[model samples]
Target: MIKVFYIEDNNGQYISADGSKRWTRLTGQALYDFLQTERGKKTHFFVDTDDNGVAIGVEIRNTELASNLKGDKNHSDYLKQVRDESGYITVSFDYFETEDGTSTGDEVIPNDEDSIENDVLRQFDLETLRRALDTLTEDEHALICALFLQDKPMTEREYAKSIGVPRTTLEHRKKLVLQKLIKFF
Candidate 1:
C-alpha cells in the first residue's frame, strides 16, 4: 500500500528517486505536517507501504522537496537510521505520477504580452482609475482629466490656472492623487 507522487521538472524530466538509497521513517502525524508544509512548494507526494498495510517511507515531488529534505542532514540521517532499525532497505516511490503534465516546457518562456500592454498604458486600470478620479473633488478631477486629455503635458502652474485652484493646493492634490494611482500600475 505504497503511493508515490512526483512532478517533472522544467526540462520535462523527473529526477530519479532511485539514486538516493535512503529511507526516512516518519509517523503518520509527522507525514501529515510535512505534506501540509510542502504542498504548494512541490508538485506532489506519496506514501510507501507494505502488503500488510504497514507504513514505509515517503517521496517528495520537486527540487523544493529535496532542498527541504537536505536542510538538516543529521535529522534525515536519524530518520534513515530509524527506518533501517525497522527493516526497510530503501524508500520506494511512484514513477508514473511523475510524468510531465505541462505541454510547454522551459525550452520556451512565454512572452509577457500583458506586461507590454501595461507599459504602453502606463498608469491605467479603468475601474481603479475611474474610482480614483471619482474620489477627487469635482474641480480637481476636471483639472486632472483635462491635463490627461491634452496632447501635451503641462506644468503645475499651468494646470493650476486651468483648474482655477491655487498653485500650491493644485500641486499638493496632484501629488496625493498621483501617489494613489501609482499602486494601480
Candidate 2:
C-alpha cells in the first residue's frame, strides 16, 4: 500500500484511518472536501489515523485522473516519487487489460517494415521543417524554440520573466514570429 504522511515541523506523521488523531480531526474534513470538489482523472486518497496517531487506513477513489497524474498512465514509479516529494498519500489505480487488445502499457513492439517506413517519412518531414525554420532570423528561431521545442516549455509569463520583458511584449513578439514562420511554411 502506498502510504501518505502529514509533514509538520519537518516530521512525517502517519495519517489515521479512524479519524481519531489530531491532524486527522483538524485537516481530514477540509482535505476530503477539496478532494470531492477536485475529483477527475486522478485517484483521490484520504488518510485516516487512529487514537495513538498511527495511520490506520487510506481511502482511495478510482478515477482516470490517475493516468494523467502519473504521466505514464500505467506505472506507479512516478506516484512513488510524488509521495516522497510531497509527503502526501500516494495512490495507484488498478490496471485492467482492455477487451480491445490495445497495448497493456509501456511495452515496446519491435519495428517492422511499415514502422521503418513511417520513421523515414517522419525524418523527411523534420528535415523539411528544419529547412523552413532556417528562413527565420536568429531571434525568431530562439523565440520559436522557447515557445515550442524545449522538453519542458515555459509559460508566456515565465518566458517574459526570464527575458526581462513584459508579458504583453512577449506575446506581441511571439505573434509576429509565428506569423513569419507561418508565411515561410
Candidate 3:
C-alpha cells in the first residue's frame, strides 16, 4: 500500500492516507498547494514510496531558500533563474529497490573507519579545499583553523565565543563548510 502525507500551507492543514486511489486525490491537492506556495519561488520535494508505486511520505523545500541557507551561491543562482522563467517545476520521486523485493527491516549504517578514511582523503585536494576554505567568513575560518587545522575541537559554546558569533550561527556555518568540503571527495 502507498501512503501519502502532506501539509497545506494556506490553511496549515495536514492530509494523509494509504492506498493508491485514496492518496491520489490528496496528492493532487498537495501539489496544487505546493505550487501556490512556490509562486515566484523554486521548489523541490523528496518522496518516499513503496515497491508498488505508492508514496509513503513527502518532504518539500524551497530550493532557492535551501541553497541560500547553505551559503551555496551557484545552486541558489541557478534555482532563482529557473523560478524567474518558469511558473512551476516538476519533481521526480526516487525509489530504492530491494534485491529480493523485501524490506530489510534494518538500518543501513556506514562503517566509521571507512568514513573517517574517506573524509581524510577528501581533505587532501589542496586547491579545491583551499577554495572552499576561502569561501568561509573570517570567523568561520578562525574556528575551523582552531579545530581541524590546529587539532582542537572546541565545544559549540567555546567556538562561538572565540569566533564572536552566536553558537547557533557558528554551528550552521560549520555544517555548511563541511558540506562544501565533502564535495572534493
Candidate 4:
C-alpha cells in the first residue's frame, strides 16, 4: 500500500508546533527528522494506491506531500543534495545557564568607590592616576576623556577629526601627555 501525507485544508503547508516556521520544507532531512518526532507521527497521511487499488509505498505528510506541492515530482528528489538553509532557519535556544557557562570565583569589576576598598593597591593606583589626570591641560584632558574615559569612547582618528586636528598631531600630543603622566608616577 502507498500513503501520501497532507493537511485537510492547508495550502500544502504544515508548520512546526512552535509556529516560528513551516516544517514542510523541500529538504528531506528536516522532514525525515520531523517524522521521527512525536508530533510528526501524529500527522495525518492519505493512502496513494495504483489503479488496481493495490498498495505500493508510503508517503509521509510533511515530507513527500510538501515536496509534491513544491513541484518536486521525482520520487528520488529527496535523494538529491539540498543547499543548507541553517542560517535562515530559526530554532529556539532559550536554555538555562549550564555548568559550562558558569563563572568560578573570578574577580568581579567594582562599580563604585566603596567597592574599590576590596583591593588597597588598586585604590592607591587609581588615586595616583586621578592626580596625574588632574595635571593635564584642558585640551589634553578633553582629548583623553573622549578617547579613553567616555562610556562609548571614540577612536583616535574619530576624536582627532572631531577636534579639527590631524591624526598624527593627535598621536604626538597623546605621546607627550603620556610622557608627562609618567613623570607624575
Which candidate gets the maximum TM-score versus the true structure? 2
Each prediction's whole-model lDDT (CA): 0.59, 0.60, 0.61, 0.64
Clashes of 2: 10
> Per-residue lDDT of 57-139 in model 2, one digit per residue for the tens?
33333445433543553355566678789997633322434677564543333458778899999999888779878988887
Best by lDDT: 4
Decreasing TM-score order of the candidates:
2, 4, 1, 3
Which ranges in model 4 have alpha carbons more than 4 Å from their true place? 1-118
Per-model TM values vs. the true structure? 0.29, 0.39, 0.29, 0.38
Give the alpha carbon lDDT tens digit for every residue of 1-185 in model 1. Answer: 44333333334233447744444443456555655665434533343445777644445546576566556555766888988898855433332233664433333443698679886676456766777667778766666776675678687788888767799998788778777667755
Query: By TM-score, is 2 or 3 better?
Result: 2
Lowest summed lDDT window (length 10), candidate 3: 16-25
- Which segments of model 3 are wrong by more than 4 Å? 1-128
Name the TM-score of candidate 4: 0.38
Provide backbone clash counts, one per model: 1, 10, 0, 4
Model 1: per-residue Cα lDDT at residue 96:
23
- TM-score quality measure for candidate 2: 0.39
What is the lDDT, from 0 to 100, of the residue 65 in candidate 4? 71
